[model samples]
Target: MSDSPSSWPDLATLRDRIDDIDRQLQVLINQRAECAQQVAQSKMAAEGDDTHFYRPEREAQVLRQIMERNQGPLSSEEIARLFREIMSSCLALERPIKVAYLGPEGTFTQQAALKHFGHGAISVPMTAIDEVFREVEAGAVDYGVVPVENSTEGVISHTLDSFMDSSLQICGEVVLRIHQHLMVGENSRPDKISTIYSHASSLAQCRKWLDAHYPHAERVAMPSNAEAARKVKGEWHSAAIAGDMAAELYGLTRLAEKIEDTPDNSTRFLIIGRQEVPPSGDDKTSLMVSMRNQPGALFEVLDPFHRHGVDMTRIESRPSHTGVWNYVFFIDFKGHTASSNVQQVLQDIGEKAADLKILGAYPRGVL
Candidate 1:
């Protein structure tokens, strides 16, 4: 006879099954951690004290593999993030990574650092982009994360300038989707918010939204979004425009969400490290080229890339500090420096340009 609906396993039975699965998950996770520890031992035996535990390219490849193999109710990105945290914990069994980022804390740079290195990393907050570079250069951290460009605001000139002075390599890249929110303190009244505080870029990104919603409100630019959130905490007449990270860090309530005028606004951040990252199957190379001032100098510099069929992803011109009239082009393109075609293109461009610095070849952002 067929069983009645009541005879089927109830919610409690399903929960018990979940408990059993959790137990199995715990066992498998510990086993993975043990394997990571064993891997560390093998590395130490092979390379002694000079062994590098963090392999950025290998990590990127693993994450991409996980995403590709994922098949579940969860999205590929969600699965990859889960694997990210798992890898983070396992890597901690070997050694924790210390990362430096531009911050007062609770900033997007910090978010990118955490996203790339996972929670197992020790993240140090630096006051400025230059400070972040200095910390990594001084061996105070394993790596540094800095904002290179924003979709809406163009390139971060300070970050680009820092690269010109530092020898750090680009180890990896992270693209973070930015969602600016209008937040207020618990004691603040949304109706009485007389002023809005945010960073200049944030203000600009949300200009249209602010104009439509709070037309008469005075907008003030602060040093950073976290600073703006902190300033609004004690003021009943002020609100802050920042991201969810800042809002949660300062215990502010979101009055409106995703207030940025551009719905798909995102920022690209770079991971700077003392050690060079080997090429992953998929990679990108960045270079800063200074061409002799002449007609078609830019074309001469770019022609080699096109001739080689190397896809140029982006190119930005910055004023050269060495000469008033000279300009440097920061170019990013697909393929790794180690690849034959990339090497040929670089050699060709090197012959044409006054100076060419291959920043580093790193795996493109997968998640």
Candidate 2:
């Protein structure tokens, strides 16, 4: 009865179909949210606790189930990200989730925060890593995002150090693929470039490219790569090494892209909060321990993990900072604290450790 008997539907009809789908999606979302409210009621009645919001273990279990049952057309990581937003939204209806990250806005940390938590969240940016933890500990923000490690570099020691004494828990993690770009003002010339600016680490990461092309250019290190981009101008004959987000934020043009040392450069970020997340099926537990400065001491700390068949994902050591001639070991393993094998390892560590602390157990990143 329409003008599109043999052809595709008209624009208006197609638009109406989209609207119909939106209505259906809205209804399903509401139903899902109503179920979450019911869950809160059940928890309040059974546990006599009204403040229970995060369930890291339960979240992990859901992701694990999805990953295991995932079929073609959608990768496990993609499916998990979709569910993360769904769950984050369900929790938000009860309380708004506020997160703090190292930012002045538009930093990679900010992007990671948004990626992990959907647009339904409030994000606060701090100047330093310690400030991020401070905001979380003070209850000003619900969570904090800080870079943990990079594929090109090693780890962010400042972040690792902050966790040593902070009480905030690692609720989740988001991994961002870092693509460094050389950005400059629209009127700038590449051949006339004489100065390059960026964070010291970023500059170091792109050392090979800089050395090859900008041998005569003076490299400067700034507080942040974004800040460096902000400093570039039409007459400066300079560029900055920063993420694409920063270039967009500062209205700079990207002269080059993905100029890092390695093609697979990515940064892993941690989401810290006062509340613990329920286990998502795929979980990682992090810990820090102080061991005697003796031979086989490090191996002894690792032995229980091997015995329990737990997979060790990362292990790094830092000078104790508490005293001279002492060190602390930070280890990340593939299991939740609530798991039988992980529990057994922790029990063994309890009996054998000089000093130890479980930083937090969080969902392993997808993609």
Question: Whose TM-score is greatest here?
Answer: 1
Residue 308 error for model 1, in Å?
A: 0.7
What TM-score would each prediction reach against the true structure?
0.97, 0.86
RMSD of 1: 1.8
> Mind giving the per-residue lDDT tens digits that candidate 2 earns over 1-367?
3455767777899999999999998899889999998887777787774465666567667767877898959888888778778888897876677889998776888989888776667889899999999999998887899999988888999999998888888888888988889989976788989899998888888999989878899999988887788888454688999997788888998888989988888889998888766566678999998887778888789999999999999999888877898888999999889899999999887777778898898888754
Cα displacement (Å) at residue 159, model 2: 1.1
lDDT score for candidate 1 against the true structure: 0.93
Best by lDDT: 1
- Model 1 residue 228 CA deviation in Å: 0.8
How much is 158 displaced in model 1, in angstroms?
0.7
Clash count list over all predictions: 0, 15
Off by over 4 Å in 1: 1-8
